[model samples]
Target: MPAFGRTMLTHWHLDPQVAYLNHGTVGATPTRVLAVQQAFRDDMERAPARFLLRELTGTFPAPWRSESRLREAARSVAGFVGARAEDLVFVTNVTTGINAVLQSSQLGSGDEMLITDLAYGAVTMAVHAVAQRTGARVRTVSIPFPPSSSGAVVSAIRDALTDRTRLAVIDHVTAMTALVLPVAEIAEVCHARGVPVLVDGAHAPGSVDLDITDLDVDWYAANLHKWALTPRSCGFLWARPDRQADLHHPVVSWGRDKGFLAEFEQHATHDPTCALSAPAAVALLREWGWPQVRDYIHNLAWEAGRRLTARWDTRLSTPEEMIGAMVTVPLPEAAGSTDADAAALRLALLEEDRVEVQLHASAGRLWVRVSAQIYNDITDIDRLANAVRQRLVVSSVESR
Candidate 1:
């Protein structure tokens, strides 16, 4: 708010012209952090022998510091969600981490996995795969639109759980609605029924306050690339060390067959640049001041949502308490608007308006979910709201 010292945009190589409101898809890393990542790559290229063999093959300070920084980053994450560092494990992203839990889980014949309609599409496939391997059943709970309260969410999940339910996958923040769910309460409900809850926090890391260890859930994973502003394909999974054995590595990399931490940590060779730059990601959050940046984004999202009401019939599916930085506000669904039409509308926003936002089908209707990050301000969001209203008006007039 203070003279825009720096929007998160300058962090990455994104063009300065675009007003990016799509941090929910994947985060834009800070320019400073990208420099650090390049340095690592350059060092690797200059002398593969010196960097890879002499330095990397053994224990290197950068990666070691990276790992330590991960723990510190984990500490910040754990502090918000209420968890310990040892309880969480860093994986590539939510997809890989989710698969690890599903494939490795000992679910057998007749096991049931309860998920909600709000779950991410990719994660749903993972549950299906688990069901195929074992004769497990997948039950999807349909969450109501314009979510009333966190209690309603908890009740919906509780009603969905049956005697055969062995696992439950929910969202810390629903990808479709961009609404935050009561993960802590959901975990408690699952534990009471002797079931484990796996939370897909795809948008939680940088968008909201996350305390991995204290969340009290059986397993969880979130994308650092989205909210935490890490490089793409960077995310992690956290389990109550006891449940670590419940999920196996998605790939049979070198990390397997080793000890507990070693098994997950030392997995196959990856472009560790993202992991190495994690400390800076965490540092940026602190540097910007987490609470200040968080409130700033959330307030902007609320303002934009309220402003849209004057343009079209709308509603808020994301609750204020549950929502932090991301807000999914529904737009009027044109009666004859086909999927193709919606895609065109989204493209128009990008190509014509230069406003980076999201348009997707959800809750049997289409909605534009607005993500507010540090780089976003009122002007950026107002541009998106105006563009949508303008297009819809033009289409209606043309139809006549």
Candidate 2:
């Protein structure tokens, strides 16, 4: 492993006083890219009418090189993730993209939507909301906390599918447990069953090598803000060319009926800078050799999990091969530790130790997830590991 040292940390505008290990929650934007975003905002502010109407609208009288900023941004992201620009559209985030897909999907009575227990909470709600309104049912697949293998994940999803299952929402990389699901295999199984697959790939964009064409999913959405060096409210939705007919934006705007791409591209009056800034973010990744950065982070995550598992004497939540840039470990159970007690422990870790991490609950158990990114190194993980171990020790003593 390479030391992604202080030089790397200087790229981001993160607080030097805190050990910021929560990149998976909402990523920290690189300062260089943030500067690019500010330029976009400044341009937008300088000529609100000209920029919005002529520039983003793609009506300015200029050469083809001066194309629409929104479209060019989409093309850059599509190229990065191995998809055609025509098939990808920018959205606020993965949650919004999932909402758009679910809202437009023709799911109704007797139809079922299959999802895993590890799905993001907001996406789970989106699935159920559409199901409830259309008299559909959501069948959740209970994947083991530390899944045996990717094959086991595929098998679980395959066994859960039924003839009534109209859609399956799978995570490329899970939110809470941080396990990378076998999305490619799961998509093949669902497609064979005549079920459309929607992948909630919130954490996959820059963390994993993505080829939407290779996955062969009907619809896939990911957040650039999470892994890519982009600011907040940035993500893209990719639909298979054949499945574009089944998709629609949540908001009906001027782009409606113009075409599928048009429908999504022209959301009324929303700032397009987040989407436009994606290329700069992608450029940063290319300049830094993202492949190397991704590998370094993955190694950091795996090592942290190993150290934490040993320190806390708790089970690892996911297997090494299935993890990318994040790992979760169950908190040691105190004699009388309740949900409230776990919440307090999380606050203490942050307020007392200045260490930020995610506390996730599933099946009535609390798990702490640690994320590794370019800005993170061994010291950050050590801080989190020490803070958690200290808290558990104190809680155990006090509980008695």
Candidate 3:
């Protein structure tokens, strides 16, 4: 309906001087969404006790309200993700939601928690912590990098599940690799082995069309701050109706015995504006038309991968179907192949070229993960391409 690319940059507060290709890392919120969050904060400060105790959670009755502000917001978000409000609750981020599920799991000495190597580092650490606390063990399944097909990913997880696997954690869209895993198919395989699935959908909400109900997983954790245009520190967890009874919030607070929604709603006092302002973010998505927005971003990301790989003389191993609004492309061998090299190259891109992107070393080569958003265009990709090439030339000269 409206123009995308630099013309759409007016809606966000991102610096014009920097070519930002890192939207998937920590999302950039739009100016309008921030203003809406500020309004909620202003209302909360006016009557702190009434807002927090009486009206925010609706656990206790308020004279003028039929539902809590939090539940109302949850309902809005649930609809967006094709979930029921009663089955979903807000958490600070994806890591928090996954931790809550991990802590509540019924595991014994021989039990195992299965996760893939592609999981976010924080999630991997959280699973390890749970295993340490309980007598359980963590088993990592390594999905082949630059996987040939989605079936290969599903098969890897299927082969990894065992009788001891009490839970299987998978990613809807991976972090470092930027591959969109076949979660539904993977869930089917895990379910056959009687293993419950928990999906870390951190990069999924805004990047692709999502329906939590269709995923067939026991639990789904995702962020609204990243692709959904919400302010920072807003994420949600969705549980099947049958799974809710056994789940507990990570923080034990006033609503301990109350239901799943109540347990998460009263997880100690913290800023609630990020969650409260989520409805505004959903509204913006509707205004833009989700399909149009998704397509524009996905196409741009694919184009970026194509152009960058061709320019760098490297290959894009992941197929287009497995990519969403972000794609990971390998850098030339000249970029170096260690974590330190990746870090130094990233810093150079930012400091020298004002082009910020996510870089990591994987499969014996340096790779750049480019995130395409509504405010980005081919010019940004060209900037990144030119900058990296310049670095390669400089490296070649110095080495001789």
Candidate 4:
């Protein structure tokens, strides 16, 4: 977007004063895409029977055509990560997608599901619930701070792996720490030892340039609602086509006939507006083009990281190449990013700095994760950094 052209930003109606650095927290949809979605919703609402029953019919090809359009936006999503399109299925969000895969999979009493200590809390609960049902054990690769390399991540996960380990679930980017794991190497290690890898790429989709087909993980789930910058209910689970039979939907609906992908798309419909909006969201991204957008967002985030790194006590958790758009900066010991506190820093920044960010604790470290999108700029980062510096300085003296 051009600096002078009010047209770009005027396209959307976000609060002008709030510098939103938290695109990672359910993306802010562009006005154009959302407008299209609302139009679809309005059309559906106006003549519910016409759009839902008559137009959609029972045959999925028509609605599936919309998904295919979204898919064409990039098979690189799976391709880059090292998976095929046949292996992938859509869901409303990663939680739903991951839960579907976990609950329906054949994990049992003697089976174990491996995960990282750094995983998103909600996902951890989902994993535990499935374990509760199947009597599977939940083991984690404890990735403490000072984790130095891709090798370190791989080694930690490898050590956690045992003969009973049915699946190893790792994060492409840790939601709390913004840390990226060496999933490809770990995938290779797991595959060699007869374990399947499930990647939680909740933050990867539109935030980073992803190619799932290139990654060796047997199962990958991503939330288009988060980084993908699509609507709230868009997410996907892609499995190796061969493993497709091994997996089933968390919700058992009309999918026994064709395959898992069909199963996901045909999820029961009271009215399919939210899910149907996904194609329009994909269309918006295609219209904007990420080449310049990625570079722009990266530069802003990198500048923010540089600012955070300049502080004496603060630490940077994410590796350079690993974190393209999101950067995690460890806050001082006193801060907390969880909701009860309103994440003082996050709220203060939003209210005062007009800069929105996410503050959370992971690995015993408090952090503020910064995210950037087409709507963000360097000035926004500057605003956030300034507010953080000002507050921490006061906090420093209060501690004394």
Score every model by TM-score: 0.90, 0.95, 0.98, 0.86
Flag regions of model 2 displaced more than 4 Å.
1-3, 59-66, 335-337, 395-400
Candidate 1 global lDDT: 0.75
Leading candidate by TM-score: 3
Lowest summed-lDDT stretch of 10 residues in model 3? 52-61
Better of 1 and 2 by TM-score: 2
Q: Write model 3 residue lDDT over 66-115, tens digit each, in one string.
A: 88999999999999999999999999999999999999999989999999
Model 2 Cα lDDT, one tens digit per residue, 288-338? 888898888899899889888787787775668899999887776651246
Runs in model 3 deviating more than 4 A are none
- Model 2: which residue pairs collide? none
Error of 3 at 314 (Å): 0.2
Q: Model-by-model lDDT, in order? A: 0.75, 0.85, 0.93, 0.70
lDDT of 4 at 329: 76
Best candidate, lDDT: 3
Sort order, lDDT high to low: 3, 2, 1, 4
Model 4 TM-score is 0.86
As a whole number from 0 to 100, the lDDT of residue 246 in candidate 3 is 85
Say which prediction, candidate 1 or candidate 3, comes out ahead on TM-score. 3
Q: What lDDT score is found at residue 325 in candidate 1?
A: 77
Per candidate, the number of residue pairs that clash is 13, 0, 0, 18
